[model samples]
Target: MKKLYFLIFTFSFLGYITEAQQLLRGPYQQKKTPNSMNIRWRTADSLDAKVYYGTDLNNLNLTATVSTLENDHDVELKNLSPYTKYFYKIESGGNVLSGPDTAHWFRTAPVAGTVQPIRVWATGDFGKGNDGQRLTRDAYLNYSKDKETDVWIWLGDNAYQDGADSDYQAKVFEQYYAYGDIFKFMHFYPSPGNHDYNSVCGIPCQQDPRQHKGPYYSIITAPQQGEAGGEPSTLENYYSFDYGNAHFISLNSELGSPTAAYDWIGAYTNGASTSPMIQWLKDDLSKNTQPWVIAYWHQPPYTKGSHDSDLFYEIYMKAIREKITPILEQYGVDLVVNGHSHAFERSYLLKGLTGTAATFNAQTNVVNGTSGKESLGEAYIKYTDGTKPNEGTVYVVCGNSGSDVAANKALFYNGSPHPAMFYWDGGTGVCGSFIIDIDGNKLTGRYLTSNNVVKDEFTIKKQSVTGIKNINSITSSISDAKVFPNPFAKNATLSFTLSKPMALNIELFSTDGKMSRVLSNSSFNEGEHSIEINSDALHLSKGEYIVKINEGKSASFERLFKVD
Candidate 1:
């Protein structure tokens, strides 16, 4: 009888083991650096947490095991290879929960300041858990099928109604799982909006950001220690990161003063704020060496979409415009993206207009007055040289990803679109998202509607020609001269064909016209000739530089982009 009882108990335990723990939240990725990654998930029950990962799906040779048995799993895989693809699977209680399939893989970030093509998908107010949300996601997936998305940026209101954990579970995480494998693959950087703040500090949300804690704070794992680059902010509400040849700043407009009893202006005031966030911003910007700088947050400095920036009650928008924009411009920030308005709106290259929409003067504020469309031969060009300091910044309002914007017309000041906006949806009933593609010195942004139609597109190109004096004076001898890798790392090969044996002088200069290096000062043969430009010998930094090849009477200027 004892043997029979023991056999029955063993069978019961084996049956229980066969049942798997269900995943509740995410298998999402965060804080992705070239050498490290953070993966988090939630299960229905407490169980031993483990992540099996490797470069090959068939052979997951590495295991990151957690000692504690908990429902929430947060695993950090460190000392990883840069720009490598790794396949992984989640396991709990010794049972495989997710997968080691093709869908369960992530590409690590490349070395910072590497000049590589990167694609970013950005959307705002997309946590509705409705058909609109599903369609918008589907459109991005369909459009980006051929290309892998490197980064996903959220423009707040990630969850609808309220920013509760339950709302995020239903509308954000579960919805991504239901729609596609976005959470499983792409890593995201998020900024909180007023709706997200509502769940953190209640309605009319006002609280010390230093002491703030809630679902939004707990769910995200941003880099607060400068591991991914930039000076450490030590605050999750706002931080900075460097990827490839670009720098990204994620700011929080929902934060409030740490000292004040009830003041909600956290990031900055009309001029400067007592808040530390502004100080951190200055420090981060001053330390940034990347050529392309893009900053994003919740409230826009200029918009006429779902929200009116002209209203005095719109304090958040006003503060960003009057207080924050001057600082960004001072640092030569290329782009500022925001989402509080529910319609798509894009501004011309602008600067020095801090007042209301009525105070906007095109003659004084508009930098590049032409439409920034490359096909129209009006692509905005920014020179890194001191010749064009604070050229301009392009502002975008892309908050209609999942939310309806029918009520935007009611808030438009004087029932007219803000004059600052060069392009806007203007209530065409278009629901969509945007994409940013960066390659070398050029960046192109496109707005794609739910139907996968390209509605608006613009391009920004960074060029350097400061030291090229009298470049158009003459032309001779030099033919088919070009840099094999214009945007290169380590070393670059400069090849040219000379019409005759002539003395050549090659020199490199920084964007500010400072001499960087004297590459060649000798005569080349008449036929094809090549010279290797080494980064080590030149001590090159990641930025734009001009190379001048002088042949006595004729000179040729070529731009070179050096990456670390």
Candidate 2:
């Protein structure tokens, strides 16, 4: 009877062990790096964790790089190659040493500063468990298949309903794993969102211990050097890095008001705009200069979605306007990418309020001759000095990567008045994503829907700085000429700047060396004069067109432009 009792007790103990193992099947978090990747998963009881990785999914070679930590279930796989692909799986030992046996793959980035077009997938507020999210992911996968992007930027709101590990797994991880091969290769750079802070039901909560702390961090890699490439701050929150020709700054939006993170941002922004970082950026631009400077964060400066535009976080917006936007403008930052509102909107070439004032204040001339030549509407300009014309910064609201809980139609209509480039109600089109191509002197941005339709397009040209010339030095007798608005648009207000008053011949030529239109051969004065040239009459395309200002046997200047 004693032996029988002993056997029965052993059986009960084994049953308890099985139940514990079942409870720990999930809750895995992984982060990728240029040379290696790290993964952490939990189990109810202590066990040896191991990972198997190889080039082939069906046959993974067991890694002796095994590490065992007490209660710490994280594993790091290192010594990866740049721009290469590999497969991996995780396993733990129990009563029978069972197998998860599931395989996954990833690719590392190419060497930094390599002369290749770097493509990145960017989106935010995409954690809804619905068709919108699925469509966005599928579109990205298709693009990745075509482009082979180097990195993926998660602008925040990664997992709605509180940034819990389970929510991330169900909404983010599972959805992305649909294209696991592409993801296995690309590094995911993420920032924190308000929803990530567990701020639901108006309750303030402490950080969840299941995942990495605050979620603000940076990473550096090869083809990029020194201070610019790596994550310098806490792995869980706040970091900065440089890639190719751009300096990417990511911030934590859910952290404390006026916390250490704020101070860090000020220091980094100030230093990067001035010293080594700026020099690096300038040098990169001088060589294979990308005309677009981009930065991403979870929350947006402007949004009309679930959050009202008036409900904008004032303090944060103020921080961006004062400390951030100036540095961006000083360094010629052309684009700011964000995700929070769940729809897409693009603004005109804008200077945030501060930059607008500075730019206008620096300008010594203004052309207010015609109504059309007046400042680009009141909404586009913020006259801080109350003297100069308005020059405002552009803000894009692109958040609809997933299903919408509700529609915010008003958000689509309100904009900076230059022209509403593109707007979409969340319920209509397939979720929105954009691709920006910076090649040589021109930058083109394309907005694509889930079905891969090019919904909207725009291009910005590189501005050339010309040296000032003296009017007295020219032998070419200046004549009847006019270039309106001096710095014209679809058409320029033409005027003559002649050395000696004479009859002038004005003609517009396409960049292809083709003459499109002839303005006048009328007689004029030696001083400043004016005339109007209808750019539409020339039928010139949007690019550098030569405007020949010819007088008798003298000279001229080729003024350029946009004909749209």
**Candidate number achieving the greatest lDDT relative to the actual structure:** 1
Question: What is the Å distance of residue 504 in model 2 from its true position?
Answer: 13
lDDT of 2: 0.50
Error of 1 at 356 (Å): 0.8
| Model 1 TM-score relative to the real fold | 0.78
- Models 1 onward score TM values of 0.78, 0.64
Give the per-residue lDDT digits (tens) of candidate 1, residues 474-564: 2567877666474576898877788899899988877665556888999888889888988878888765566677888668765556654
Residue 556, candidate 2: how far off, in angstroms? Answer: 13
lDDT of 2 by residue, 118-155 (tens): 56567777776667777777776675565655556677
Using TM-score as the measure, the top candidate is 1
Q: Worst ten-residue run, lDDT, model 1? A: 262-271
Candidate 2 local Cα displacement, residue 196, angstroms: 1.4
lDDT of 1 at 395: 88
Error of 2 at 477 (Å): 19
